[model samples]
Target: MKDRAIERDMDWLVQVFNWAVRFRDDSGRYLLSENPLRGFDIPAELNPRRPIVPRDWMEKVIEAAGPTPLRAMLVIADETGRRLSAIRQLQGSDIQLGRTDAWPHGAIRWRYHSDKVNKDWLVPMSTKLRTEVDRHLAANPVLGDAPLFPAPQNHRKSVSKDRAGAWLLTAIKRAGVQKLDGTLWHAIRRLWITEHKEMPLRERMYVAGYLNRQTMEMVYEHIDPLLLQETVETRREYREAR
Candidate 1:
């Protein structure tokens, strides 16, 4: 069985077993122990794959999206390195356009509430991204509590993840980029994380809303060969100077 399928089964088993334990004649004697199947390893080939969308491809996708809200979403995802779900849940109130004492380039106070972690985190947006967001907000004024990317059918609600993914797919098609099967939206996030090797690990983790270095390195970080080479050269130069 697939890792996810196994996980689902294990979860269901736990629930059923716990329910039985709670209602049994000898409940104290029927306690469910730790799940033996909790850490089943997924085969590398079966893992959900995310293609690395290069900076040029990202530009093309944005260009294809034009001045639409989708374009803003794409830019924000790339700049913030946030998960698609978190990006979709963004509210107008979360955005702070003008420069702040803490964030000279301006920042977005993103609230991510999920099973992994639930907290409000701030991340600085690039000048270009901030300008784009400002233009978008100016063109389409919304209430502070309204969704940043409001649903077309309902302005009060945020756009569904499926709808956002469809918009990204359309942009990818229009841009003539290779279709990356299951990697369209998420690959952008991966690209964003991968490109920030210059940033300190702790700072990167905080900015990316990651709980630890292990998860960041194992799942998110995709070291670029060119970047690695550049770093190696810099080290060599420093050593020669000494």
Candidate 2:
């Protein structure tokens, strides 16, 4: 397992051990005499940096994903920069196709109940995203409360995150795309965030549903030094004119 994964599991196990220590039976005796794993030192986690998914890699994966629902998920991730947990739980009701004064191209309404931050967000969709969503809806035809991407064996539940990742991995293998550790889904999200670096910080935060500015700036967004230099050079004249 990756260092971060190991660290996370160890932390969770420590919590479990603590809970077991406090657990009492009907006789009011503790279930565990003591937390056996107490004072066990977890290893310091290594840096968990991941590269952004290249546009070519994404194009190849999307093309090779074929008729599967994973294609739609990939497109959404690339376009919206939403987390896999949020994307997988998407329902037909969450999308608003009709144009509004605020959202000319329609919008997506992410609910607080299902969001990782437990906050509601309503953001407008791009024309490309709207078209893709419309096409997916036509093909899958899910209604209110039903998951857009339901499990093949069990329609009652949304497709598991692991299963979705596996599907993406399979597509990656088929497309002959390589490099980086795991979770190409998040890599795609990183690409989306990085691409919007020129946007206002607050607007980008709102669109990406990011509460912590540090994580959004430091983790998700990968700034290109050369690009920044070029941007500054290009805008030098405008700055001088003012």
Candidate 3:
């Protein structure tokens, strides 16, 4: 496995050990004496910067995707900026259409268990997103707890992560977009974040299901200096000096 892949495995194992150490039986005795790997030093991961997908490239790919489940996944990724894991496992129950107190238009409830952050996010759906989702759900027609995108072989389970990635690659090829390094499903997410950089930091973080501000600003956002310069030019001080 690659270094980052191995690091992720070690992290998951450590979490397992921590859970086991905390588990108790009916007798109130600890299930495990201690986390064996509790004090183990995990090397810092050297992750490469992920490039943001251009809007035109993404649109081309989405258009080329046809009516497959991948098309919906791409739209969700572009609109919500949430992880692919959450998108793949989306259920009919997760969607609440029509006006709500929280969301006047509608909302998509991202369940805690399905995400890495372990936080439930009620994200308001954009008009474009709602239209696409409505079209998909109308055709697909899933009831409560039924996965929006079920596995072809087994309808009981959602499509595997590998399968989803493969579908995306296929779409990219059909669109004739040069698949650059680090431009994966997550790249579209970065694009979403970059496009919404004008929003208040905390509010953006909440919408994006981010727990840490640093992670959102440092990892997910790709700052465009030209865009920043244009925004700065609009400031009172710059205008007054002209």
Candidate 4:
């Protein structure tokens, strides 16, 4: 079996053993003491790499997308840091365009089933993204229940994930940019998270729909190499002051 599969099976076995121990005559005392996956090292390549998309390259891709609805979709993904699947699944009713007293710039309430957390959630959209979405909606009006980014060939159906990805790839190629190894959409998400590193942990987690700081750190945070020196200098200054 593959290393990852082996690791998963080992983890499952450990959980099962621990549960079985709870019902034993000795109770929790006889539980497995060591992790079954302790020694096995999965290849680094097996893990997901959270790469931040370069802002310049992203701008070029967006420009290459022209005035299509796909461009709006890209902008939303970048501005709001929402998952591509969640963004693609957005319907007209999922967006709120009215001018709220609290937010005069307008706002969007994105309600979608998040594949990552395996749950449905409503997240507040960025004001800029909401404005871009408003423009897209005004230009290409659809029914309340219809998809915001409907398939070009079928108005009733939402754009397929593959088609949306292909659109992005075509734009990337047109802009003379090389595609990153991992999903392009994820790179945009990473870029958003990286840009907001200074935001409070709670607020960042809330915006990204992450349940915990551990998940945010493990899956979302990707510090730019360009900022490494600055980060190190800040840390050094703080330590010296203390």
Candidate 5:
């Protein structure tokens, strides 16, 4: 079979074999002992794809977005460290600009069932990010419990869900942040995860919305050169003082 494989038409072969056994088998229930190749995965490289741009470039993209929906979308990335699902799930009413916590930072509260990860976690709203959201909401206004940015003015639909990709990609191009990594949105998550890795395990977990320490460590941990060097140098200085 291997020797004549290229000439034999692998695609048609599998299709015909499946049809014959599934439909024509006498019992229709008889099964082979195993199908060893059933679980095989396609190589990622064999599939064509682009990648994420760096965070600095992403920031530049948001700047280029100017007063457009593009800027609001990017600012949400900075504020919530939210998944795109979480972002889309927001209603203009959900942003709590009026809430002032005793905590140093401001706050954002949305519903528990709003996104894929069904937990309700409140993210700290840094002053800078808070200002950004207030401004975005002010400019965009509320058409409904729909997308913050609908299609371009000429297009006819108000967004029902998951429109971050289209607008964000346009923003990226406009900003000229063109080098691509495999998952662009993920790079935003990566930015948040990397930024907070050094916080105590419990604290980082709470901020990133992990239910507990172990899951947070397992999923979000990444080594940072500056942090590692700071730890090592601090230890050496302490030892010298002793």
Candidate 6:
């Protein structure tokens, strides 16, 4: 993999690593946990900052995705901030968890069986995306063990990394993000938590399936876009005396 894609892959791995940490019982998960990847042992050139797709860019990307299941999936991801692992595994049973066509709470649930969070994950489901998803599920009512996204039809029809990347590339184009590097599914997850900074650190960790804040802050420090943008903008208007 090239340097650009390497960062993308690392972002993906970070989410997986985080999940693995959460899945494991207390005792230090692995040797890597204690051994810091920092310091002179690390090469200077590897200290590159990974790029992310701006939220505004995500809007365009969703528009550009054209007509495909991947498009709606990306839209749900951008709005809900779910890991692709959970997003791809969405099913009628999952969506129906504590929701209804009438209530419209704009949140969804992820079952442990199909989640990398490998437990239960509850996330806000945007109104717009839910309409689209519900429509799709309505068409395919044969809710078998398979997920809504692309999975092999054979015995172990799990989602493959290659297919995940392809679906994401299409979303990247639709999102209209210009980057020195590309983004990954996990980046979408980080974007959600980073975008919601004021919501109590622990709550963010629970929402993202992180065992704690130290690890959440470790990877999310560089993502500077805060959840306060709306508040700051509104206050600015008030201060302006218009």
> Which has the higher lDDT value, candidate number 3 or candidate number 4?
3
Q: Clash pairs of candidate 3? A: none
| Candidate 3 lDDT tens digits, 1-242 | 56666777899999888888898889988888898887888765687557889999999999999988899889888888989999999998998887877777688999998888999888898888888888898878889999989988987799999999899899999999989776497788899899999898887887778998888888889988889799888865545554
Model 2 segments more than 4 A misplaced: 1-6, 10-46, 228-242
Computed on alpha carbons, the lDDT of every model, listed in order, comes to: 0.78, 0.84, 0.87, 0.75, 0.61, 0.61
User: Runs in model 5 with CA error above 4 Å?
Assistant: 1-53, 101-106, 143-162, 212-215, 230-242
Residue lDDT tens for model 4, 1-242: 55656666767776786565555354435455555545655444366446678889888998899888889988987887778877888788877666666656555555645356655555556766776777788899977888888898998888999999999988888889878877788888888888888888887876666666886776777866778988777753345554
| Candidate 2 lDDT over residue span 1-242, tens digit each | 76778888988988898888899989998878887877887875566667788779889999899867998898888888888888888887888889988888898887787767999999899888887888888889988888988998998788998899889889989999895566677788898899898899898888878888998887788877789898788853445544
Any runs in candidate 1 off by more than 4 Å, and if so which?
1-48, 114-116, 228-242
Q: State candidate 3's TM-score.
A: 0.81
In the predicted model 4, the residue pairs found to clash are none
TM value for model 2? 0.79
TM-score of 4: 0.75
Question: Residue by residue across 50-78, what tens digits does model 1's lDDT show?
Answer: 57788999999999998899998888888
RMSD of 2: 4.6
Residue ranges of candidate 3 with Cα displaced over 4 Å? 1-42, 45-47, 100-104, 228-242
> In each prediction, how many residue pairs overlap at the backbone (N, C-alpha, C within less than 3 A)?
0, 0, 0, 0, 4, 5
Which pairs clash in the backbone of model 2? none
Q: In model 6, where do residues sit more than 4 Å from their true spots?
A: 1-48, 97-107, 113-117, 139-144, 152-158, 174-183, 221-242
TM-scores of the models, in the order given: 0.79, 0.79, 0.81, 0.75, 0.64, 0.62
- Where is model 1 poorest over a 10-residue stretch in terms of lDDT? 36-45
Tens-digit lDDT string for candidate 5 (1-242): 33233323644555555555455346656344344334544233232332333558867977987887657767777555566666655666566556555645556665677655577776677777777877887877764455555556523344433456767777777777674654566667656767766567676665656665664444444557788898888853345554
